[model samples]
Target: MAHFVPRASFSLPGSIPKTYFLGHHHSGANAIKGILNTINLVIECRDVRLPLSTQNPKLESLVAGRQRLIVYTKSDLCTDSPAATHTLRGLYGADNVLFWDKHRPGTTGALLRKLKNSARAIDALTGLRIIVVGMPNVGKSTLLNALRSAASPEKKAKAAKTGDQAGVTRKVGTSVRIVDSEEKGGVSGGIYLLDTPGIFQPYVEDGETMIKVALAHGIKKGLIADEILVDYLLYRMNHWNPGLYSRYCEPTNDVNEFLTAVAKRDGKLKAGGAANWQEAAARVLSLWRIGKFGRYVLDDLSDEAIRAHQHLLVNPHLSQNQAKKLQREERRRARTGD
Candidate 1:
């Protein structure tokens, strides 16, 4: 087994509690999977931007055979209605799912009501330990703060000291437990939330994989929302997502032609009648940040993980590393049909 590292250390009040959080893909997938290997019923942030197929099974396995709820976090930003979010619960099974938006200061939406309703649904489990998990800037920290605030009326939760800047919650995750939620005016029940660092594609030799996680979480798009942000994302994603050539009328084969066309279109040509190729390159990057290129999937679909999944398919019982080493064994089995 790869040695597990603690993202954030919890203040575990009594014996390590049972309840936890759940999330799939980009950040929380693998570790949430590890948590599911232990217990049931975790609190998870809902990211509609990510498709179900891309969600890592480590987290999904936990959702099966027990109670699960979906918090439609950042619902304020969604183009969908509260009724639309509610329909998902019906589709997933009435009691199986729920939605909430911690982004809104007050819990006015259906999901907040659902989280409040979760208590009545599962009467026996009073102290629900929630492992609220998600990627950075997807509001994992923000959700926890809101939940903490709603629960306590006086002296609400102090902001968890995370940065508003991108990738601020770096390093092994650290968690803060709401040991006392009675004051938050929430149902006076037993619940402790563990916050974790946003997961990302691990480095092989460089940060190439991390850019994929950034893409999955909409951080790149967010950065592009501003004119300056557009420039940054364009620079990175131009080489990152070569589909840029087709998006605008530009030469696909020649990098120079593509850059020149982008500058000419933006009317940023040099006084010497030369295409401002440098500026064009900058413009392309800006467009992606600004969402002109359209949404695309970029996560830990790296070669290493794909290879690992394929290896697991053959050696159903081998450990992740052992399976990688047993490639010759696989070849032998393939040759012998044993």
Candidate 2:
């Protein structure tokens, strides 16, 4: 087993990759920039499973100056507790963040009220144009579809295509009317939504965050080795609850051994009856992705991690150089003594 590393120990990248900013004329960060001046409210969608890591610092940096509301999406897939929600509210600011599950009835109504209240200060004379932004596969498109469906039964057509994979929305699609004053029953407003391509900052200095993001399907598949991901999942499950994988294999901490046993039991064998452990590892990860094991919030935001994250969030007075230096030193200290 690898040595335990606290979530607070890893360093975050200062900026994202330039490629994320480039692409189709109407897509990427450019789309948001073009309409930045016009957008009244920004709805920042994040995976409920890894709220902190998948918030995308690069995207946050751009919209930092705007009137923004953080929407924690995919609540249906997460097993977050009330205490966890309280902790998140404290971390991201209670008034600015909200939870959402598209599958639940009346969820869109709650979100609409919150949006209207949050953007109450903005003068949306031309109607409120709310832009939905987030990393890939966090259901940006799916949320837009839900909103459209709830707004009007006649407007049941899908505005954006959605899939279990990432990067499905390659370009910026035309804006759709999400709410109207004539909608009668729901929240009254002239609300429009634009869906943008999934973009990320260039580098991620931490290993655990990357792994959690991948496990949550925020990052595209095949970018990381399957076995490595499976190994990390095994470690996380063991740490969270011992013998979590006992139903699939014998109780043990050896990831490889457990995978081998699983392969043999499932009759996944290569030539000559050798166990196809790689296939078994991929299957394990697939199950985790679909929440077959159980709902999980992957980022371990313990008290220590929360304190450090809060410090980073509230310390805006620190100079850019000073902030980078502090992050570097924190990572060094976390690694050196451990």
| Predicted structure with the largest lDDT when compared to the true one | 2
Q: Rate the local accuracy (lDDT) of all candidates.
A: 0.45, 0.69
Candidate 1 structure quality by residue, lDDT tens digits, 182-226? 455544454556665554221111123223334434332332223
Question: TM-score for every candidate vs. truth?
Answer: 0.48, 0.79
Model 1: residues with Cα > 4 Å off, grouped in runs: 1-40, 62-64, 72-91, 94-109, 120-126, 134-138, 150-158, 161-185, 199-214, 217-338
Candidate with top TM-score is 2
lDDT by residue (tens digit), candidate 2, 62-82: 798898888888787677344
The runs of at least 3 residues in candidate 2 whose Cα sits more than 4 Å from the true structure, single-residue gaps closed, are 1-27, 80-82, 116-125, 183-189, 310-338
Against the correct fold, how does model 2 do in TM-score? Answer: 0.79
- How large is the C-alpha RMSD of every model relative to the true structure? 14.7, 7.4
Q: Can you give the lDDT of residue 310 in candidate 2?
A: 48
Candidate 1: worst 10 consecutive residues by lDDT?
A: 15-24
Global CA lDDT of candidate 1, please? 0.45
